[model samples]
Target chain A: MAKSVVEIKNLSKIFQRDSFSVAALESIDLDVKEGEFLCLMGPSGSGKTTLLNIIAGIDRPTGGELHVLGEDIATLSEDALATWRNVHVGFVFQTFNLIPVLTAYENVELPLLLTKLSAAERKEHVLMALKLVGLADRIDHYPRQLSGGQEQRVAIARAIVTDPTLVVADEPTGDLDAYSADEVLDILSRLNRDFKKTILMVTHDPRAAHHATVVRHLEKGQLLPVEN
Target chain B: MWRLVLKNLLRNKRRSFLTGTSVAVSLFLLSSLAMVYTALGKPLENADSIPIMMVRRATGIVFPMPASYGARIREVPGVAACASLSWFGGYWKDPANMFANLAVDPENVFKVQFASTIPPDQLEAFQRERTAAVAGRRLAEKFGWKVGDKITLLGSLWGFNPELTLRGIFSGGPDDQLWFHWEYLNEAIGRMNVVGLYWIRLEKPEMASRVGEAIDAMFRNTPNETKTESLSAFMLNFIAMLGNVRGIILLIGSAVTFAILLIVANTMAMSVRERISEAAIMRSLGFRPAHILRLFVGESLLLTLAGALLGIGGAKLLYDSLRLTQIGQFAFADLRLRPETLALCFGIALSVALLAATWPAYRAARTNIAVALRHTG
Candidate 1:
């Protein structure tokens, strides 16, 4: 009975390369409800990340109505979209794209810098986020000083620090070993279950999909039926 | 934001330091050239207040004029005082200790060249004692000469070597010369009754051109024709002998400025290009394009401003240290780095920062976030 946090109807995305046009996504109909951990599983170049980007307001769709949180994202300007993303959505990339120059604490505080939060409030939020990921002790450590799994945890902390409505991750465990992969997946699962954070993740590993509440497959830019 | 800028600069310490050093050296050279140019014009800055004129042979300064011309020059309607000034090129001990030693008419030199402040008793002693010489304060300090010290000058221009007593030390107005009695040099040179030039002081600054014309006309078409000009024009002719110093400084300054611009532009371009992915990440975190641009520009400003401070400060320190040295005392006696010059250098630094960072920052800001992220991956 949860309200739908994302709604997409007949969405299409086409990329133009010189004189040729390639359809990245065609007539994609998808709905993600609040508190749902939706896993998108597909092969390479199957429009998984393309759809995720569009839903996150990072890229624009070629046609059809696309709405997230009941707002038509396509109608928003670039700056407005960026502001909306800052307030409403969080992102975790596969490569752990934390600014190398910033420390773990500062990296997590990046999004809060855009908000009107005071220094004390930002400190509280950053420390709490780092604590959630069990990285409070490494708060002052630079990104290069941390291990691969730890760096990914820091990225996750940065994503959730702002307490966004939705967290979208693109192959967050693609570069991790088995143990670190499970650790990242466990954290994502905990965020979805305990914090009731809505997560939309793209993955290729079947094991990652096992942690999802609802799983869907895509083939050649078209969505398949949801797996029970 | 500033914290981020600092960290980014520290991220590549070697490159940042090298770029900053280049800026520092370029600005140092540029400011030094400007200081020298300004120093060359220092005498002319107060020339109008003094209202003095120099009358020399029409041919050249090396050609002597009649010392009797001083009496004729003094008779001019607006002339307040006239003195014969003969260059006595001599060295104190070694050729390396060479300075401007002049044989000036003791009775009227102070009246015409009143900028030099000499005590009354010393001025009287200088006029009474035929072999008395007065050294400038800086010249005395350089050679450690005191009052009553007998100094011997080994003349380079004339065959006679003159021994004289230092009667007084004057404090102001090109205080780098030693002045002895012109009558002494006249007698030593077999009573030639010839002088190198005449220094004429006008009763008022407005009478400079009229008095100069009258003086020149008085000696025109005679065996010794005279050319009279204001002190500033005379200094300009003297500087002209140095062979286009202003043009050379401008050329070198322009080349240095352009080179630093290219160096800084290259550095900024490389720095931004290396961080395209990081810029995209920041944009994804809700940093606007303008914010990104400000960040890069702030870094460049910080870098260039630091360099400007170093260069300007270094120039001041270096020149201030040279103020008492032989070269500084003789040539750049009043050399100073003016606040206007410092402000101008700062403006140049700011302009260099903005120009260098704009294109690279713009490219990075306008880069597609998705494409940048993918490309980095």
Candidate 2:
């Protein structure tokens, strides 16, 4: 009964290399509803990240009508798309791509800098996000000072600090050990169930998919039927 | 944003310090050379206001002229005062401690060379005593000479040593020269009625060239032909004897500037290359390309600004501490760094910052976010 937060129809992506063209995604039809944890599973080079990037407005599709939150994102300019992403979407990369120069507290405050928030308001939001990830004590610690699990948690805090409408993560736990991987998954699952945040994740781990409400497979850029 | 810039610079402390030191040293050398150049050309800035002229032998300044020509020069139209200045190249203690000791006509020297001011009592004492000498304030301070101090100079040219009493100390003019009675030198050198050159003061500044031409024409075709020129042109000729000093300073400054530019450009390029992945990560976080560019350029700007401060400040500190108003024959009476020079150095620093950061920042900003991320991964 939840409203559709994302809608894609007949989407295709082609990459050109010199004189040759390679299709990354073809005839992709997908819909993600609000408050749904949608997991995208695929082998290597299955256009999983490419699809995720397109949804997050980090990349443009070659052909399709793509709408997220009822806006025609494919028609937006690059600058406008970036602004929209800043306000509406959050991202978690596999490598925990937090700026090494910034502390954990400052890293979480990065996206808020783009907003019209005052200094007091930004600090409030950053502190709340770090506290949500149980990293209030390590707020002043740099990325190099933290463990792998703590770094991923800090990245998660940075992703959700702005309270975006959708959080798209590409293998958020792909580099973590089993214990750290479960910790990251538990946070992502908690963000979905408790905060009602819509999450679209790309993963190769079957165990990660087990935490998703709906899991879809993509083999050679074609989407298979959803598995409940 | 500034915090980030600071942190990034501190990330590579060694590289940043080396780059900054290079900029500091280069700018220091450049500004010092520029100050020297400015000092050399300074007299020309107010050349029109000074109505003094110099008349020497047509052949060269070293060639002596007839001291009797002083009276003829004084009779010329537009001539206010004329004095004979004979160079008594002498050293105080050691030949290495050489300075300009001149035998000047005590009666007309102050009238023609009025830039050097002395107290009324001191002026009278100087003209009354035959072997009296009036040293410049700086010269007196340098040699620790006081009134009634007896100083002996060993002449380098005439093989005569004169024991002179320091009667008074003058305050201005080229404050590094010592002047004594020309009649004393004439008596000491076997009554040779020969003079080195004549210093002529004009009724008006506009009369300089005409009076110089008139003086030269009067002595033309004689046994001792004369060449007369305005004071500024005379000083320029003195500088020209050093062989294109301005050109040499400019060349050295330009080379130093170019070398610093290349060094800073290399530092910025390396910094940007190392952070290419970080730039893409920010881009994915919805930071615009222009923002990324600003961040990179901001880092470079801070770096160069630090260098400029160190360089300009260090130059001022070192020069002020040294207080070297005179070096050899060059007199930099007011040798502080000019405001224009400071502004110029700052402008150079800003320009270097912008030029060095533009290409690297542009390349990093415009790179495709997906490709950059994937390549780094």
In model 2, the clashing pairs are none
* Worst 10-residue lDDT window, candidate 2 chain A: A219-228
Model 2 per-residue lDDT tens digits across residues A58-120? 888999889999999989977788888888898999999988878999999999998899999
What digit string (tens of lDDT, one per residue) describes model 1 on residues B1-377? Answer: 89999999888999999999999999999888877777666535566767788998888778998888888888899999998999999999898998889999999988887789999999999889999999988789889999999999995678989999999999877678999999999999899999999988889989988988888898888999989987777777777778888888888878888887898899999999889989988888888888899989998999988898898789988877765234464335556777777787778888999999999999888888888887652
Model 1 agreement with the true structure over A76-109: per-residue lDDT tens digits? 9888988998988999999999899899999999
The DockQ of each candidate is: 0.68, 0.64
For B1-377, candidate 2 gives per-residue lDDT tens digits of 78888999999899999999999988898778877877677645566788888999988888899899999999999999999999999999888778889999999998997889999899999999999999988889888999999989995678888899999999877668899998999998899899999999999999987899999999999999999987677777777777898898888888988888898999999999888888887887889989999999998899988998999889978887887655435335555677877888889888989999999999999887777877552
| Candidate 2 ranges with C-alpha deviation above 4 Å | A225-228, B43-48, B56-69, B76-78, B119-125, B128-131, B148-150, B155-165, B183-194, B204-230, B326-331, B375-377
Q: Which residue pairs of candidate 1 clash?
A: none
> How would the docking of model 1 be graded?
medium
